[model samples]
Target: MLPDALRSRLALARRSLLPCRGCLGPVGEGAEAGLCGRCWGGLLPLPEGRCPRCALVHAEADCPEATAWDCGDALWDYHGGRPPLGALLLPGIKQGEAGWRKALLGRVLRGPLPDWAAEVDCVTAAPSAWPHRLLRGFDLSAEAARLVAGRLDRPFTPLLAKGWLRGRQASRTESQRRRLPKRAIGLRRGAAPRGLILLVDDVWTTGTTLLRCAQALRAGGADEVRVLTLFRAL
Candidate 1:
């Protein structure tokens, strides 16, 4: 049998020969990177007109309701009723399509960041539920936070630790979701850091989870908390 290092190198070489996952076009010189320039450009110019505080689409110039986080941003608006192409790709990501997932996330990270992000002292993620992590085999939010931190040249910290809950928030009714205990998420014993923090998450549904995370960060002594999600469910 091939040595472990040789097998790993061969696997990477095979992946390098694959086409771009987004456009299914020839990866050419960028094969190792998983995306071609054209396909990467297609993901750009993310839909705008979202409330910077809640990341919700505001028909008016401002959000009517107040948001718990100091500010927020999202890559796409997920119309939950019909869903968008981005939403459709989310399931594939959670299913462990690493190439497509990395390409999509790379596009987002390479794009312009919010002005407030410049002031961010650290980056962290809203931890995934234990059951979900066990089933998905990866932490989507944590990966996103790491990518964002690397892109922004900020420190990445796992500030929040998730505790198992009775049911998945996605499977619960809006009212039931709202009733979820805030303590479902807690601050990591020594992970808290001072100053502005950018909390990353894969999606925003009712904002309850992010609120709980922000509360935990505050309780742990974060001066300011902001959220950055890949998509917003509207």
Candidate 2:
């Protein structure tokens, strides 16, 4: 039998020759050649008509509640029609697939950022509950935050700390999520930085957790707080 390292290398080589994950089609040449042209075209962009404050898609005839954070943007909308690249990679990321995580981070780094993001003075992440982090063997939000900080040339700091596991937000309904209190997340004492702050997370479902983190940052003296996520459940 082939040695494990050789087998792994062979597998990687085979995968490199296969169709791209997004469109299951041939990957054409270029900087983005690893991803097929069709799939690259399919990748969703943040809607231009979203709410200015929360980045929620809004119609001309409708208005959303006042958001707690200053402003936010997401790489893709997570609901309706076919799943986007972020959704396709989420399961692997949750299962601690290093390659998938790296791909997701790269996508985030190359994706568009809100105009105000340029003014962000520092970067941070919404804290993952310790229990969840232990189960996954990685902190998804922290990893994304670190990569985003690197791309932005800003400091990545652990500004918020999860006090306890309030149970998985994914398992809860919208009403249940709305009932979750602001205290579910707390700001790390003395860790909050002055000036504009950018908070990163892997996904946005109910917006409860991000709101709590933003509130904590505000309490800790952040001049402004903004959120950026890989995907937002619509």
Candidate 3:
């Protein structure tokens, strides 16, 4: 039998060769996310009933962590839509599928910054551990933050750094995630955060990472912090 890792790679390889999920048109050779440019350009808006602050779908519009930041919003439901773009693409991006970055960025660029995002004087991102960055060959949150900065006409600042020994959030349970040490993430040396800040991340799963980075920014001297994530996990 094929190993699980090899099986997943074979599946992704096959999926890459299929026609675009949206239009059933032939995708480019070696396409990632199984979508053509036109189809990718046509991704729809996120479904409704999300917390305006946290971006997660909840019974109440305001999630318990809604108040953790000055304000925040996300682009799409992590597990929504027929293609489930978030579910389909993010894992690949996180695992170093650099080719998928362009497709994902195109989708995110379609969602303009909210009115509140205009007030952000500076843009920054939640830190991915240096090891993960090395393994993945890119950091989605950081790259997306750069795109957001360009869209906002703001400067992207490297605000926080993750401790070398910290664990990956994806591998942890909810309780362990909530108990993440304060030292796991913190202000970057020589960084002087100021005015209103926008904290960017790839996905908002538990809201723990964004909240922690916001706290770091505020504690480091930012007057206020707002967050914008690409997708919100259910």
Candidate 4:
């Protein structure tokens, strides 16, 4: 991370070269976040009862009636056009801009999450398949977990690894995404943690990944597993 003095100097340089698109006013210092405070309200959280499993805004409560998807609700719907995500996800993860990591951590800290998250024993990120990490150059989920743990003042454990032979999640369908194989996650070599666990991720589309993570944590002796994600795809 850049020191505070250097970051302030960089923000000053950015203000000179960039202005707020909303007001066309010179974005004073610390406005690289792009939008001024007035324009930030549009990103406020929506109410629940969308998808009980993922907290997505569904047209009706009983979504996809035939399929019985069971899991704790998510915070937002990421599949929908959540414009702010472009400012956060693509650049930070795919492009390796570490600055967005802190920005995203700030958002999650301010966003809706279970009260239990504050009391968990430790935090961990959903394991990504080896191929995706190799191709993407960075593991966005793991990075987000570290940020959340820092903000929440909780331990961040690197206790999970991806299943053997599974590939990138982007290529899989909703059905195929469920039912993670037994090889999907394994504990790191250490004494098993005995209390609650918080799993962090960048986005929650169907929650197939989080559910599998919770299952793995339970098998490894974690008493409880809670999930926190930056966005939920409605």
Candidate 5:
């Protein structure tokens, strides 16, 4: 028997007439695993034996982003499989769709924390431009970080600050995004998180932003950094 919370989500997914992704739906029988689109979309397990840090099915040569973290992981691989259902998850949160927050945190609880995650000392987030934060109901990264912190019983702090006038990174081309200025992100004044820090963000596109946040933490003297995003764009 499912818990009340899960029972309700499953019921709602059944009510949504949208076609399911693969095995998740097409009406009829009730059981766990594949109920409907939202249920499946809301919880995509990380790729088997792959890694989120590089969004790779297998890291061949050393990934360039490895330099910035002790360990990094995300809940879902944005491009891990066909049709790219993972890609839509981030926008649901950014657009302030109802229940997206709870749905995201639900992903975080899908499995036990990875062995590497046990060492995270503090939780912080990649800073978002203020206007985007306001438009999105709050800084998505910050809210995600707070949820992680609460679960881990660690302190959640705003240690990174984004440039005041910077425009949305999504509006820029891949080259433009990679060229994001180093100074575009920096440690907030007086913020000095020691030991391992977990950096949370909404999505990992080029990883330029997440790495930038990790870089800032290292510059401010954090011993190590780990990265977590709700979704990882492969």
Candidate 6:
């Protein structure tokens, strides 16, 4: 255990390191996490007038199959910026940054929550590879779920687990992504999270991961599943 004086000094150092929570930018007096105003403005709420199911723009008429298994509701289209909206998430998922994680969570709160997320009895996250988690010292998806659940005042869960480890998905093409084994995700034995489950993750790419996550939830006795991602790949 750390000595009291040393622990207190370390705590003060950590407090000094955290940025304002609002903007994920710079520190300010009395600011929550050193977030500055300009970075705060970068957060984009989920736009109005999107398909209820997939959150894609559809004819004013809803997609005929909107109700099938539910789909993703994202905050921003991924094409506006050169690297796109979800760019921040890719690095954080592959790398690690507490500040980026906090900003991503803040983005989720600013967006429209899918009915499933709003009504889900509990929230869970897609599990990262154990080796990756060990290297990072934290699971990005779980961190995202915790932040989101805190914002929504709902329960957060870390029940899901990866069934197989795989290479990073960031550089892989959609076709390459499809080739990933079906057993990439699974639920822990006898630890199902029932009811509507809100699955949280940093990014939605090719939709395969989210779909697989939904399947895992369903297998775990989840009656329904909805996704809340920081950004969607265009």
lDDT accuracy of residue 195 in candidate 5: 87
Best by lDDT: 3
TM-score of each: 0.75, 0.81, 0.81, 0.67, 0.79, 0.71
Candidate 6 lDDT (Cα, whole model)? Answer: 0.67
Candidate 6 residue 179 Cα shift, in angstroms, is 2.4
Better of 5 and 6 by lDDT: 5
Question: Compared with the true structure, what per-residue lDDT tens digits does model 5 show for residues 38-128?
Answer: 3454446577766445655665656555448756777776754444555554666577755645655665755456566666888898898
Q: Tell me the deviation in Å of residue 214 in model 5.
A: 1.0
Instruction: Arrange candidates by lDDT, descending.
Output: 3, 2, 1, 5, 6, 4
Model 1 C-alpha lDDT versus the unseen true structure: 0.76
**Model 4, span 59-139: residue lDDT tens:** 765665222223344444443232354344444446555555555556656666666567878988888777778876778
Query: Could you tell me which residue pairs clash in candidate 2?
Result: none
What are the per-model C-alpha RMSD values against the true structure? 5.2, 3.7, 7.2, 5.6, 5.7, 6.0
Please give, for residues 1-234, the per-residue lDDT of candidate 1 as tens digits.
999999999997887678766567666654434656554444333357656787656677667754667588776655331224455557877777776777767767676777888789999999887778888788888988898899889999999987885667777999998898877889877775578999999888788899889888888898989988877766
lDDT, each prediction:
0.76, 0.76, 0.79, 0.64, 0.72, 0.67
Candidate 5, TM-score vs. the true structure? 0.79
List candidate 2 segments past 4 Å from native. Answer: 1-41, 60-63
The 10 consecutive residues of candidate 1 with the worst lDDT sum are 77-86
Q: What would the per-residue lDDT of candidate 3 be over residues 1-234, giving only the tens digit for each residue?
A: 999999999987887678785557788753446667654543445557656676655676446663557477877667665566677678867766666778788756767667899888999999999988887788888989999899889999999999978878988999999999988999988999999999989888888888788888888899998888888776
TM-score of 4: 0.67
Residue range 1-234, candidate 6, lDDT tens digits:
999999999987886677644334455553333444444444455557776667666675756532326666766655433223355445744666676666556666565665556676788887787877888887767877887788778899777777544776666787898887768777876677788788877666667777787887887788988887766654
Please say which candidate is ahead in lDDT: 3 or 6.
Answer: 3
Q: Which portions of model 3 miss their true places by more than 4 Å?
A: 1-33, 36-44, 57-63
Q: Which ten-residue region of model 3 has the weakest summed lDDT?
A: 38-47
